[model samples]
Target: TVKPPVETVEVSPPETPLIPPEKERAPSEKVTPPLEVEERKEVEKQKEEEIEVEVSREEKEEEGKGELKRRPEEALERKAPERRFSIKTIFSPLTTITESIRKRKRRTTALEEVGPPLVKPKRVPRTLKEELPPADWRVLKEYEVRGGVAMIRIYLDPETSNYIYWVIEPPLSDVEKDNLKRLKDLLQVSLPYSLEAVEEERREKFLLEHLDKVMEDYRIKMSENSLEKVRYYIVRDFLGFNKIDPIMHDPHVEDISCDGPGIPIYLYHRDYGSIKTNVAFPTDEELDGFVVSLAQKCRKTISVANPILDATLPNGSRLNATYGREVTTRGSSFTIRKFREEPLTVVDLVENNTMSADMAAHFWLAVQYGESMIFAGGTASGKTSTMNAISIFIPPSSKIISIEDTREVNLPHENWIAGITRGGAEAERPGDIGMYDLLRAALRQRPEYVIVGEVRGKETMTMFQAMATGHTTYSTMHADSVKSIVYRLENPPIGIPRVLIQALNLVAIHKQLKVKEKRVRRITELVEIIDIEPTTLEIVTNQVFRWNPRTDTFVYGGHSNLYEKIMDMEDLSRDEVLEERDRRAEIISWMVKNGVRKFWDVARVVGEYYEDPHRTLSIIEKNPEVEGNPLEVFERAAEKGRKEHLKAKSVAA
Candidate 1:
């Protein structure tokens, strides 16, 4: 009554239902479709067959003969399951079925549009030929320095006929140079002003960190190769000797001489004589700055007010520099006699043909007997080197004192005192400690041996007095002959009495001259100071060994005053003393043959011989090279002896 009996209307069903009613049927039962559905299924089945046939024909064409072909039965089997699944799909929602059809079409279209995948070929790397060294120069040798960051190429210029020490470092690109400029500016502001206290190794680490920070802050994009190149330049300029850093690292270089600005730097190579280098200060300003820095490294100050600087660098190399044009005409000048880390030994002298083994053995005997001697030579004549080398011959137990203006004397003796002269701030040298003071203090200390680096001033008198007082004093002087040494000692600056000159036992005159077009250092004359002739009041000297220039060999004089002294001291005959000298010579020869040239290694050998002569000789009888480090055997023997002595002492206690 309310809605006209609900309008009793019936709704008819459509041709397809979303969810079809399931009829109970056996598992093997098959369902047949209506006419139009059967026709549609047949149309789909024909399309699928056509697609399969097309795929099979393409595959057969690709595989060619003897390849397996797809069978129709297998294709039918695979499609049968797909056809069965389609029936269930028919009852699916219209939206879902339409979405699936769209997806299939999209996949087909995408595949057709994309076609075959494109593969990019690898890029071929370019082979860059290294730039050839200058055509005018012939390369004598090329060796790496600075941990392989730089190379040293020694070239011979045929036109000029001069050897050039060329330093080859990594070439920086324009971008890298710009980055370096910015980074250096940033580092200069960030780093502390005084890095003198910082260790060399730590300074490099700090520099690397600062470089990284600068790059990050400015967002500098640089490749690792470029970064490394930039770092090398920074370290070389900041921590090292700038353009001359590579030359400094070369072990073969003995001296670096910078005459003036704009002049090619000259190097004294151990084998190649004095040679010009590719490195130079192109401007006076740069050379002045370098000279100032060198003075600072020596803990000294140099300015136009104080033009001359004579100081020792931290590495023990002697430095003599002039600050400005006020003194040096060209500009600033500097001379650096580089110090050798591994000091030359007696064995080294023999190996380098600087001296004969016989002379070294004679020095060995003289050093043992505490004979006072002086090495006289000009500048850079290797007088100091000879003294240092022969000093190893001093008995291991002797109390020795070495006094020098610079720290040049290095010894292996445990009971040794090394004294260096201290310069004063004022011109008068108010708080100065000179060699004279050091010599006096050394006398009070009661040293058996006194080594004076050089005798050029009042200290020569004190040294002679020390010699007279039975202190075996050795020194070096600027003299080429015995008479010159006497004259220099007895002159105004160093006025030693004629009698006092007799206290000196030996005088070694060293000279540097060319032999076979190569520079060589030779002990021109080994003269022994016998005594002062009463009639003429002149010093007497006996030539023990003389260098024959024509033969390039040392000639032995028939007799040596040193041998006579040794015989008198040991109460031995002349023949016996000569035999002992020969034995020592043989030992030095053995060391040279076995390449035992290190300072400590030679010291160990000499010390062992001093402790027990027969044992050292017996050990040498065997092939030391075959047995490995001769030091190990000596050390073990020494250790065993020490243990035995300690045990005996304990028992006694």
Candidate 2:
């Protein structure tokens, strides 16, 4: 509050009327009385009243000496006798100036005890909220990423409406930046010329040697509050994804891209859709330098001759970048398809309308029984993510191996071996580990399930052969339709003789579509391969499930050739297999309802269910957060089995 400026009574000083100048003055001017007789009498009366009030105050002070000794507060509340003569002089506003000063100090201390001023104060950093706030910046949400939590925000630009942004908290300090530069120089000095060409995996080993000392030196230079920031930025810039690392960690960001220098970084946001960001590469030279650094991190290099680069980040994000203006007029550019650290589970897909619960339940049944499936989709159609999510349906104890050009498949199974194809000068050499090489090696490993990240070339044949050998295969191919999938398989480079192609049982066509103006990827069609004509090599297919674009719903043909194949393989009656599927579906529904979305949590539930179904059901059934019957799977199954038993008994009678 603006304090009233030292409250004081208005006092009129006695005015002096000017006499006429000597030249103009008449003899009568000297004789005239100054200020009139009435004014003089009034002034005299005011003086007398003031004198009387002072005398009264003196008398009261003498009488209250005993009270003042007992209670100091009482003196502040005391009223003086000068109500009419309330003019305040510096000497005596009310008795001693010292007493007045004490009272003012006490009131000021009380005002401060409550809170700061009501008006917007200067920016100040607090433990939680910031002291200083710019007019525009507003944080929309905060979420944890790999190394640190990130803040996602939106703000109106002068021209544009709003732009989405991702920034990590505990921002890096200047000293840390200096430390990072020093560390990078030190790293280059320590490595041999040959070792410098090594891939990201090996570079990590090289950097690890001096990381402790580097961190200690950085830590010593930073303030106590800045220690965490130092660590975060160090990991983020050097060990993590660098400038893009903040957005890469955001689970909501599906894609992170920088078009070129002077262009803002754009992120495809899960909630708000695509939005331009504040992050930008300031110049071509600077961007090229960063891209070169990114290449080295990926264990690759970019130059005028090798201007294009494609690689995977340590976190599994796909990086497609270009160096210099040789490729195009625009400066260096990069697009990163950020991979979620915790790959989505079946619950995530069902909730997202990418596929229905019934579809997931079917996948669960088929996958568990070792039925091979091929997920085909256009680019950015969520082929790999769906493949990863459904892989959770595989029994936890099963040994699984995943092969890819980039390591994208995330499995919960402990016995899983993830493989990525090698690149650079040694790629075609005998020591090279390509996708086909990895697949051949994986077969020897005798894995129960083999996952191929993507098949675009010669590796496609090996993947199908792996499936033909009774290895339950999970792989993705870039094909929009089942017919297209066959063509790609039978065509050159991927040349699987049409006969060997029939080994692939199911073809799930996943695609992105606009529903109600919003983009969503759904299983547009699911086809079961029944036969390949012996004479004509004509592929026969059973269209089991398809998405109805008009209704934005999945059409599941309840009967599947694959499921029938499952019946023959598992040696179980149809009802028993169906019951198992329903039970798994129920477990998934329970988890989705209870907010168990994390991959680890979903994996735990599936593993626990495998160990003890009833115990898992009981755990869910007892959870108060789960509404209705969490044990519906068991209850309904028991009822169905009991009815079947009664029918059998009646037949015997």
Candidate 3:
């Protein structure tokens, strides 16, 4: 607050005028009368004496030594003394200068008495609330993703008794929307041209640094927390799948589908199955642009001329899209099949009850002994997952090659080659590198094991040829039974000869069925191909394992040719082979119990077992309930083996 400026009153004689003369004269030109000058001198002397006394008294009062208790009447009487002289007599230059100096001093003293001015606190900018699910819906689960920038809510709709997948993100305020548009515009021009070439791990950091530069240059102002909220959106849209980014981040989500514009996107939850989400593009242009962006992200192109795009995303998710309304009536559509970064292991399968420990052990033995197998199942029946899980059983030292139209198989083996097919530029297929080409080339590499993502075309024949040539192969197919697998194999597109089918020694049929009112995937049957009947030419088979729907358990057929083969190849007694199988089964059970299910962790343990079985078994027997990092012992063993291998190579050189 400012104190009022001090105002001083000058008392003049009653006969003298209070205002200056209209015709003012300069000091040099004016001459004062003798009587007036003498009177001014006397008046100035009296005023100086009174001023010094009043100033001394005021200073004493300020120091709290005493109070100036002069009455109002006495103050008036003191001023009355000044009225004895005429204004012209007392208004000498010296007297006027003294009065002006006194007034300025009073004003300065008043200002010094005031305190610091008040300051109002800054107002925090408000943010929009996150949108919520319907009031009537009950939330089954709610979890944070994208570092709490987004949330996933699984709610049950009372009206339809269906679960809804709801994605909640901070709603953009009008100011934020404008700022985002500006930022995108600025970033387009300022960002480095080689952004796409950045490594996946460094891309986020790079973009964040670039964004900071751009925003700073443009003079954007925001709180640190507000800046982070904006950064989340920028990263989500620029580096991730815009509308479905939250769902994509969710580990439990396996698939995401967009039927068309104005339709809610759907996602497949591992526990809740298929559910409709709350995010969608409301306009055809928006969806078409998104689809085009997806194609570009996959390093492919889609347009009205060639509307359909089937490719693998950078993160190894399978993307199938159709552009425009030419092929699909509902504007544009897409389906993404997201695979886990760390593929499931056989131990994970056993833990999830997708297959029993016995079945996993059987696969472990078969895969170890170079037995070719095929996983047959309907769509979304966990065919590829099961195939991948069992693939971890392949001996770690084996040279493996995998070819696919879209990348899905992920392995922890070092001696592995991953190949993806490339499409031709034209419809005539002049330069198309199909899966068959990759598979054929892989065989030339002399891989000890071959993995085909799926057998839907002529590649099936090459796969069977590889199996016959003793290159233990694994693949998946869109068939639910051994007969259906045979039918597809012997049909036009695949067209494998009946004699060549015998090369496949094992087939695992997977099916999706409801058990205990919940949808689940199970290996319905594990069958083996024995031989072709001489007279009827029917493919003879042995049922090694079958799932019992009533009890949700697997029943062993009591006999396995795999065991007989093991006995002959290893030259061990039948009891000895059985005991080994049982021991392997026990090891699988221990892994499941101790939660050693990560792909690389399982691979380390398996490799250690191959390098030294007795040591592995003894470790497990001693520490049945291993505390932390269940594969610690196995990892140390693997590390030692690596050092030895490197040393031997160096010595040889």
Candidate 4:
């Protein structure tokens, strides 16, 4: 066994070679190239020198905390890598991951601590330095910052202890903040003391500095000549702080009149309804200048060449002005009739006691039956208002045509055509379609009704012709009575014959009466055009139905020819027609009882009855036992009429 073992183990396990300790060197071992040994030694020495520098820097930092010290700019120095390894080995995955995580956390903490940075843009400042005003002038208010300019309100203390205000234009700039502080300092020094002497001395200087710019603006708006005149007035009137544009927009002023240059200016107030104001001019020259300014505003010349001027204002008001030497011997005169914001209606007339209910009702029936009516009255007798109110009775189905010099008729109808005549420039001008032309054209249009605002001239003939041709026409003339109307029509300009007057169904004379210290309109007479004899025209009148001067009440007659005509047309007996009239009155009374006194409500009820008479009757009967049982009265009157008619027939048989 020993021999076999020795034979097998012969060279059997060259004992596993043991590695030498030098060959198994640790990772801390530093490899140095033999050729660069001196360089490595120098590098080591430099690292030692850097260690000394770091120690000194630490000592300096400690000393700086307790006392003043110099900067540490020369302390930091470059150093070599501590450990030697391959590039890939030096930047290992583990080391890289740890360093990246540490850097990310530091950035997150910094962002959290700082929050969002401010993003507002810097503001520009406003300064008042170059165009330096008086030292006493200080800002009182500021308004309307626009286009890099601010409207600054400044105050000045005058001798009267009153603080006068002025609007100043200030530029926005970078030094505006500092400039404002300087202005405040100047104001504080001079504003509280009596600086009138200084102010007077500086007045001309300040005015000269700013007047050019202000005058330039005014000159751009007006001519150079006008600017000169306006400047004089501005100084004379003490209107330096007032806004002329806003003054022109005063609504309570009906007119602004100035007779001559130093004359007193007058303003007609709507509330007072007269020409009176606290404002006035010192001299006739000033008044003349103001007159010229007003004329310019009207956009019409009022010189010797154009003496008389008539124009419409921007506010829809009529203006009339006369030049001194041309139209009038006096310097300059003007009158402005204010435009109405709201027009008067039938109810307004009634409420104002301008017209009676009976007159209104009669006119209503007249207009409804297509009868020709003429309204005669003096100036301001509410002729047009009465005409307008009566025109509302025209049927909805009828075609209406209105002719006038200016649009005035405001009738509420579905089928209506309004025509206005064009005034000729001169007497010899042709193609001027006056009222005559309008009347002729209206006839060709086949209108059921024709309305002429005012009949003045040969237009009377055309209106009469229209009435003769079966058109229901309405017109107003300037007169006091039916006789006067006839006289005026038959006179020179309007030669309407007496026989033609018979074509008119009725003539209503309206008069302005002074009652209770107030002017009121009343229908004095309502005459029927009965006949025209050789030398005289006959008019049938119901004086009993006239308005009484003593009692201020309108009297009623038993029956009129108009009532007969309506009865005949409806095939109703006299009693039945009277009953129908009473029924209508009762309905009106009921409406008044229900607190419906308005004319529009009355009109609506009347229109409903016209639309469906049977339905209206049934509605009235259903509500019997209530006040104003109109249907019961109608039925009773109708039965009585039937019995009377049968009795008459029996007597004839």
For 259-369, candidate 2 gives per-residue lDDT tens digits of 787677888887667887756666676788889988887778889988988798766778889998988677788888887777888888888888877778888777877
Pairs in steric clash, model 2:
123-132, 124-131, 124-132
Q: Which structure among the candidates has the greatest lDDT? A: 3
How does residue 615 of candidate 2 score in lDDT? 59
How does each model score on lDDT?
A: 0.76, 0.67, 0.77, 0.54
Tens digits of per-residue lDDT, candidate 1, 361-434, equal 99998888888999989888889999999999999889999998878999999999998888731224678888
- Which pairs, if any, clash in model 3? none
Superposed model 1: Cα runs more than 4 Å off? 1-133, 424-427, 624-630, 633-653
Q: What C-alpha root-mean-square deviation, in Å, does candidate 1 show against the real structure? A: 23.3
Backbone clash numbers for all candidates listed: 0, 3, 0, 12
Runs of candidate 2 with Cα error greater than 4 angstroms are 1-150, 156-242, 424-431, 533-537, 569-576, 612-653
Candidate 4 local lDDT, 180-205, one digit each (tens) = 23222223232323323345557434
Clashing pairs in 1: none
RMSD in Å for model 3: 20.1
Better of 2 and 4 by TM-score: 2
The local lDDT score (0 to 100) that residue 393 gets in candidate 1 is 90
lDDT of 3 by residue, 205-295 (tens): 9999999886665456776766777898889889999888898889999999999887878889989999988787777888998999999
The predicted structure with the larger TM-score, 1 or 2, is 1
| Reference-based TM-score of each model | 0.76, 0.64, 0.77, 0.51
Q: Give the TM-score ranking, best first.
A: 3, 1, 2, 4
